[model samples]
Target: MIDEPEPRRQTPQELRGLVGSANIPTLLMVIYQVTRDERWLRPPYLPTRSKGLGDHDSGGLPEPVQEEIRAAGVRALLDLQDGRAPAIALPDPEQTRRMLEACVGEPVDRSYGEMFAREFRRRAGADDGPARPVRGGSDLRVLVIGAGVSGIIAAHRLERMGVSYLVVDKHDAPGGNWLDNRYPGAGVDTPSHLYSFSFAPRDWTQHFELRGELERYFADTFDRIGARPRTRFGTEVVRAEFDEGRQLWDVELRDSDGLRESISVNAIVSAVGILNRPFVPALPGLELFGGPSFHSSEWNDDLDVTGKRVAVIGSGASAMQIVPAIAPSVRGLTVFQRTPPWVAPFEKFQQPIDPGARYLLRTFPLYRTWYWLKLYWQFGDKVLDALRKDPDWPHPERAVNARNDGHREFFTQYIRDELAGREDLFGKVVPDYPPFGKRILLDNGWYRALCRPNVELVNEAVTSVVEGGVVSSSGAVHEADVLVWATGFTASRFVSSLEIIGRDGQSLREAWDDDDARAYLGVTVPGFPNLFLLGGPNSFPGSGSFMHFMEVQMRYVGRLLTCMFDLDIRAIDVRKDVFDEYAELVDRTSATTVWTHPGTDTFFRNSRGRLVFVSPFRNVEYWTRAQSAGLEDYEIVAAP
Candidate 1:
């Protein structure tokens, strides 16, 4: 428990002011340093000062605890100040000194980013001396596969740097997943504002943007970023291999006309995300089913559901959204649930942003910053509190601590409230697991949809796909003409579908043995010189916005490429030891998060039951690691 402050207290307005005025500038400063965006500061209230117990007048922590908190905050701030994310569970001063050596590959008092930038600028010929204007040579040629968010970002970066690069997408147009998944209620869970690229900001029309809206946002962003001119639509990357002798990647491509062509690029950025391939579980009699059947990721538009019984398999995120959105239109919807998800009540999960609020955010920068800060705090920081272990809490079977237990209770209350006056449906809707044991879902009309007369939630796995319907493990059967498989992707298998061959005939699949998808700072792998991965393994923070992770990766990769160009280096690859050590640390940190809870079985873990999908560390910790790519972490090769 925190120590009391002699019963002294401030007025309500004063307290309000304290909460409102708390360290927003500091938070803004950190965000600005990382994103280099002046607009983030427009948020009114600062959350940093309030986040720490020391700033609260009602209580004060013990001196030692306070010192630790201060140290952690300082480390996080310093990391941001240096363009890196903060480190989690920062080591004490002595341990810090030791880790510093590992980070820099040598003992240096300065931070990792400072050392990196110093080396980078010196190599780029951008250091102190007067600029000798050398004659410009051919523009850097980069080939980006998959014109999705990452591809668009890569193209934008290349355009901004005046480097020539072409974006090739297999789809008819851009917006990778947005284009691919047109299922009912397909939308982004993360706020559209924060979900978008930091370089390109947009005033999203709705809080919960539908697929079309998100696609439009992407198109607008692509146009604004000047990527549209360089995009090759309906083009696909068949094979990409590194030419060790030439130090360039030879990419085989297929255009719309079925003509094969090859392109040589100085560098290749694989922006094709983890959800590249749609997976279908092998069930007996799957081929015998004559009705319309498709994966949720590949929703079919030709099939109508207005007066048909539908059986939706898999109770994942997509399943939840699809069931609710399509329930009204379907004659009857039977949802197959393998495991029930924990639902958290969000007041505005399905509500549209008020026009006034939108006006303020779009017109007034301060309001927008304030709004973002609120989201950053609620969505990112508060969860850390519940993760702390409680020694006195007896019910470890439910949650790890009092905070966690409290969260469970609050969520349980929400479920009960949603099911008020309908006790019959309560048994069906209530989840058996603790809150966050599974990926906590926001109430987006899920309960209301389930309450409908035509919708039935089945809690059994499908045993077989029969001619007219699917049979469950319990011997029960549900008849349906249309079956939508909402079963999720093979998340643990990073870069699973990509046919990438590296040095000495080494395949990316064989290199990792189909399990270990390790990368140095989740960007580059050994023997895959000049190839950068955007959203690689162990890079995703389990509880935060993926855009935050993407931003970190983009900045880190950008810095590394900048360093290579500056140093006249032709290739940079992660050292094996560095990659292993980082992966080991990721595994260690993941052990403590709820993702590792024994009762939970999430896609975050691989078939080996190893936590591989969601990163276990704090977002700040990732920010620290990705902000600067340590030279010692990689091996550099000069132009041959």
Candidate 2:
């Protein structure tokens, strides 16, 4: 027998090479969650300061010290798993409240502690018991439109509760926007770990995954949960009518061959997310263009743009991603901008996850959960204070208040540094409005792309599309062989394509005339009985990952369905007064945010100048509100 090899000793740099620099705090947090030792929560190991605040310095600890701390933490984990160290008790209600408060640097409502504990158990795999099917759910059925994230989630929860349901998607597969959008550099801006479902943790290969990876995640999730057989692909819901007498919904569907069929169900869930519909701007002579023209969402891979001149219109999130991707290959690129977006600098925006980190996420216990929690605290409400409009602030043009001004200065400096030598593009790239006035975009070498010699950034308004190219308001025409429309969706038009008739033959569109959309907690409406909306109006969070909001909404909807079946209720409509009260609160809260400021004009607002696309509450607030089904808020009718 040969002598045993010496145990490998890893240095701080070596460990970081395995994990990432941004994941150091996450590793320590995993140890803290497992051991509940306060020693793991001290400085140099865990972050003592919050992000977005001026005090968020890294302290620049010595590399050797960091190595020692990580080594000890690793040893502790091993000992705990090997039964050498005792497992600590879970945090009590009060302790959880204080912990969340400290983690977020804000006072959290006590109700969130319960939510936190439930989530903790679920992520820890301690709560994987089979769902106790509702007693009366066998007789009920649901029709979920669109097999996207929201639709998949709705189906999963419904099936777990033993409810009979069917999912219909227009695409050939389960991924919704993910399936439809195959544009270049299509991916998520949120961190990959936090962007995923809490129950289904994935070992993402990139810090911010691309479109293919995200699409695969959804498809795999669908297959794993056995939702594939229950879903009808290439099927679209054309219309749905509520039969008041029978208390059921008659839904019309169209297949790929244009054949129509109708089915009756007890309830309906509209999950055709807000971004499904592509909005191509109505420019003169658009139909007369001879070149290949399409929206960014409707990307055509067949047409090769290897060396052809390409014209890209719009400078929003999608355009930001597209410009940097296609700039290198195109013979020349012309980008038209209406308003410059504030691009925040994130070093890991384009970096892939380390193999060692992926191994830890897949192999280690509680590592992914701890990593999610760290991201939640860092990105959750850290910048919420900056979005609030300071009533007495004098400078409204530059920023809303002193704190907002500070953020503007920081972001501006980042832009300045990124474009240091290219001073000509500075004024053209920076926005004049306050931060969060529009959706914040992550930088993916956008400025660098704009500085390329083959790329041209035009700030003029596009008048129309001519025979060979686009005409600007300055009487100049830019020629191109390909034209791309990155103009975003008509988000205010909720369920516009579907003709949903509610009680007494009232159309949903007629009720919300002029696109003034409103709903009760973004799930139910007053006249729409036995109907629910997923990714509905004002349901999107102003901050944090949108997947978190969808999970909360689906859970709440599941509880409502369970309660209805258990109570023998045929129809449940939200009280008119209750809907009014909630809508008023939403309006009041939205008025105080930067989204409604004078100088801002964003897609978040509707035609009537109301903030209908995004919710005004923090992530915690929404989670607390959607934690339970408020039976008292509805008018329940007994089954006929």
Candidate 3:
């Protein structure tokens, strides 16, 4: 006898556990969406920091009122999950814009709202439809190089579109930079929620997760998407030559066994990201160092440094993370700084997520989406204005303008607060350049690390690596048992290691002579037909989650490929005029930003002092441009 299933229990604890205070605003917004209730749009439920957009302000609400709202939200969530509530229509473009503006505490344009709505719908499993096969596009064979974030995203989209593809990487597995950079304190500075793929959300335990968790996330993402089976590990693409007659790319690959092979594919997606290569400066007597020396990217974990003297070179992002991590353990730690970086304050930079927050993210419907969007607003384009040059302001060197000067003051004050009573460290740590002129680092106890008794902050350039340790420009040799070069990558040299020959046998190196790498929308080039770059020149978002940029670029690439298949086109190249125009626009926009300021010398700029690494446009602007493949922007050639 089949017994009727017992009614599922719904208790207050279960409901309360499903939502957190951080997500209260979002839950209310969703309730408003479903019920059209004006009550959900008011005080305690709504954001309260800056006219209902910034941080959550629950202090104004009585405890009883907050509880009532939570109870209502849980009931709504349960109803929605149990199919008791009718499905609500996706937010209209205007509603989406206003909602995001209210959530972000900043004015957002229509394009941003539309982008957010599309992403929201997609994440909610309410997007247009699942990817269906195109009737005429079965002959496409694409090769994606690198199994990093960009490569994984590109592969996932290609599979969704029902296109045949293969991914190859030099590493044994996925997680490009995460896999390589396993130094003492290697982790992402970006918030974990916002740093991940929008489609594949996880309940992150930390605000800024470490290397292992990130690597696991990437591996899990690759496995979940069934991308691992399509990837060839320990296989590196050495060169790719476009066969103009056949309209295919002949890719040369070398496997782990030192065996070379060639594969012909209809198109190529170069996702070997900017940060793969390690750049160790040619310091005098570098090879003469008698102790163990290594770049932070190529970390030697087996070497023990406890109670040993360790010299860390470069005070960039990596150094900022490493010094704090190793200072307590090492007997003596000397940090060599070429220049001080502008570190922004973050309260939870090193804190883990509360259990209640994790519970809300895991159990509640649309809670993670709302949280991500809120973070996107807070960290995304909000800082863009400060990066732009104010023509009316007189001080361009110390700061870009009054707003940028305010930022400088704020950051300086934070530093002063962190290093209170230690005026000696103040002169050594404060940067002279404008805020956002360089990559802004999150202060993960970096100031506190400097104040440690065992740690010494040397603000002098390293002249050479002596027999025992690093020799500063002041002619003082700082001895150490280990030397860690935290210097960054050759970011401007996009895919420079690979020999890629395009139309008329012109190599990519020759096309980008003197490291003048430029691409249309940072994806397509004039001579490189049917070849797309994932994280190419000018693709780095100046101030936002780079993962968002990757997703946008991948979608654009996917759209381009789908268009090619639909039109029966074999190869597509950006028009030279279009490429030149876009390059000029990029250069012009860059000239008006702080990255191009004369006082700044960062990896963001190329050898010619051009802003080659970072994008000058807003995230929403890039999203709008990358949402579609403009057929007129390229010259499509039919297959022979």
Candidate 4:
């Protein structure tokens, strides 16, 4: 944990001003956490449930009641500052659970109380966490692939474990998808407060940060964590083969300069992330297009389309952002959709964090932690219940369950409201699939952009490309001077490009059989000993931050490495039975979710329409399961 001082304090006047504008619920939680005050948890101070996805800054409380809580909270916070009052230790688990329930204005399960407590911000002076058992120093040397978010996180955990490691990425710098996907208006659909690393907090300006700022956060984080010295930029992993006798991975890497190098390490972490390779569809006459064309991931920064006609051939996340960003400037914009996505209402999309709110987050450590925790709960497992399938539900065609139907209604109304007078655009924008059937996008003027006179939304699948435009399956040609393919990535194809040759010369590609990838807890494979997969298949949480998921996985990896070092084990291969059982569990649970809904096309599914990409488990379930790595689940090889 970072042992720096508590975040810098603001002037008393500034604190009052910031507290005045802060969320009453979060402020009340902070007050209770800081001063051990039971009053904040009582009747008048308790918050009402903030419905939908909005922040509910006022906590649905009357102005006088909010002011009263703010006044009391500010006083407690002021006392905690300077030397007058000490930062109070976090209360016991039950109390913490009560505080969480009170803040969210709903019941927080007793089981998740401890997990909630641990995930509380790890800033200095916050003694809410248990001390981690440090383990390292052996013959272990790790090769971490990709310097993206997961890779950076891997390096940090490795350092904490005292393990020797090297980070390699094809890009000259860090920021994986953030680095590669630089399309206009590209930003996070998740809240900024929870999207970032728990250890390295930023006083982010916006709730959902754009690509440039998010990219900078990663690059800056890479440097701040001292990963640069241990990282080899512009290096790509060509192949990694397991050496049966030596219990090491023989890795080959190619540099940007075309130089090749070979190395052997005790373990290999494929931090290469799920969404690395861009998938450009092979269409009829795509090469015949005379004008400039490129995928959204490979955006042409210098090729400005100030007045040029542009065709965006995808209706996913990237297109949602790009169509709106270029709409005002482009002479004409045409969006082609194979299938529409469920777009949720994001009130804070592209909106700046208020100056007062920013001050509260920046100045108060407890306030930041509590506020962040609130976002985590909102964006996380609270929504998982809606995705659960109910066989008894009559309208299985539209939603998985009654709760799921409610979500569909909410999202449908949101779309209708956004498309109000432009009813023509509604049919083109709304999806036929059930809610949460695929990745749900957040509306950042996507619906509004379609209403523009120059913007045309085409619901037909793009049949081909011609000299000047895209040809839809309806045989209509949409003309354009430029084409932006936001066709997404080879997401289900885990650890793409790099060939992994496991024991018995079984290739990872052969095991996955091209897109049917499975991992035991989205980590290790049976034959690939000491080869850990970070952000592996079926580990994708349907909701919550990927950053949080990666953190827990890395921690589990550290524990496994610690076991290996302490036991003098040469290699620990995940037992075949254990892996199979886990995979079976994943498949069984997946059948109960909307991702497995028949005929709904998504990157979440593989060739046979199996849900291979996303995890069937809730985010909390994964966090609880991955808390510790046990050697019993693996076949341990002894050192020579």
Give Cα-based local distance difference scores for all models. Answer: 0.66, 0.79, 0.81, 0.83
Please write out the lDDT profile of model 1 over residues 121-223, one tens digit for every residue.
3222234222222122134577888888788877766665555688888887788888989888888777666576655546666776778888887887788
| TM-scores for every predicted model | 0.78, 0.93, 0.94, 0.96
Candidate 1 TM-score, C-alpha based: 0.78
Candidate ranking (TM-score, best to worst): 4, 3, 2, 1
Lowest-scoring 10 consecutive residues by lDDT in candidate 1? 51-60
Q: Cα RMSDs of all predictions?
A: 11.0, 4.3, 3.5, 2.3
Poorly placed runs, candidate 1 (over 4 Å)? 1-138, 384-393, 421-425, 638-640
Q: What lDDT tens digits, residue by residue, belong to model 3 across residues 1-640?
A: 0122225644656667756544555666666666767656555555554421123534245667667767787777667666665335677677777776655544677767787888777665576234887545456788999999999888888878888889999899899888889888888878888788866777788888999988989888898888888899999899999988899999999999999999999999999998878999898999999888999988877877899999999999999888998898999999999799999876776687877667656554466667777777777777776788899999887999898898889889889999978999999889999998999888889999999999998989898888999889999989999999998999889997689999888999999994889999999888889999988999988887888898788888877777778878788889999899889999999989999999989999889899999898888777887775477788876555
The 10 consecutive residues of candidate 4 with the worst lDDT sum are 124-133
Worst 10 residues of 2 by lDDT: 51-60
Clashes per candidate (backbone, < 3 Å): 9, 0, 0, 0
Clashing pairs in 4: none
By lDDT, rank the candidates, best first.
4, 3, 2, 1
Poorly placed runs, candidate 2 (over 4 Å): 1-22, 43-61, 83-86, 97-114, 128-130, 638-640
> lDDT tens digits, residues 1-640, model 4?
2234446775767777877668888888877776776777888878898777778888888899998888877777787676454345665567667888899888888877777777763543364222343444534689999988899989888766667889999989898888778778888888988888876788799988988888888887888877899999999999999988888999999999999999999899889888878889999998999999898889877889999999999899899889889999999998888788998888898889887877678766778878877888888877877888899999989998987888889998989998877878787777777898888888888888989999988888898999989899999988999999889888888988789999989999999898889888999988889999989988878888888888888878878887778767778889999899888888899998888888488899888888878788888788877875488899886545
* Candidate 4 CA-lDDT value: 0.83
